[model samples]
Target: MDLAARSPAYEGLAIELAVEDEGWHDAGLGDLEAFARRFVEAAARRAGVPDDVETELSVTLTGDAAVQALNAEWRNKDRPTNVLSFPIRQLQPGERPGPLLGDLVLARETVEREAAAEDKRFADHAGHLLVHGMLHLLGHDHIDDETADAMEALEIEALADLGIADPYADAPEHL
Candidate 1:
């Protein structure tokens, strides 16, 4: 993946983006990289990070098997998830050096499956996952009702900017 163009928020940040493809065999690599970068930019803006914040991040697009293993190892879940974020560490006070935000791993198969099940476009779902992962990189979580609501609202707004409809608006009744 090529990351020649970066988000304005990462202008002065000594950031290195490494994109890895694990044989997903669906979408083109360029599209995936662009989508990942867009997600990072949106998330950075939402987190109130200045364009000059020195941050480094990486993204990996993998198949279900790889993600399933990761989910099992890290999250203790047997099944593959749409996305997983691994943040490195938080910077302490007066730590003026750049921070490594860590990696985002996305499952191509899971993303497609969820998109189909939710009656949404695959690209839109992928975009949402990217944004979701980026938020995680920024230390956001939705383990509770209130946090979930706020996170979902932010996701909706972010998706809207990409001309996507609210993903949770027409959730299945059973859910």
Candidate 2:
């Protein structure tokens, strides 16, 4: 999608979207602006973001090659991942957030494969990943078992608000 198609604001949240993969259209994810705006707002609300705080987020929908390149450059991993979150600033506990939240990059092929493997709708799975990435931008992490559980719980709650099923439910050990 073009920059002009990016959503300017939603409940004080501004989203900049880049659709670099035509596969997103081929996969039938029609009009991601509204979908993304709604999910991000839901996540911010669940994360206790105040109404007055304005935030900015960028999302890129691309193929595995682009994501793989990013992964190799940023994280030193040469393989592609489902989603990548790059938070502009990591907030401290009880710290107020800044205007620029971060960016999210999603790989269409990997996301689609994972969704099919998990028996989830593509839209729902993508929403889950968006929520997961948003939480990361909001200073949540799954670095350890305790933190992982906490983050997972938060994800479940946020997804619940969106009428999405618990992504961890009825899943394989690896998912």
Off by over 4 Å in 1: 1-7, 12-25, 28-30, 90-98, 172-175
32-124, model 1: which lDDT tens digit per residue? 556677767776666556667777787887778888999899989999888988878743322332467778888888888888888878778
| Candidate 2: tens digits of C-alpha lDDT, residues 57-147 | 8999899999999999999999999999999998743355688989999999999999998889999999888888888888888888787
| Candidate 2 lDDT score at position 64 | 98
| CA RMSD, predictions in order | 5.6, 5.9
* lDDT score for residue 43 of model 1: 63
Query: CA lDDT of each candidate?
Result: 0.71, 0.84
Deviation of model 2 at 133, angstroms: 0.3
lDDT of 2: 0.84
Ten-residue stretch with the least lDDT total in model 1: 90-99
Q: Which parts of model 2 have CA positions greater than 4 angstroms off? A: 1-10, 173-175
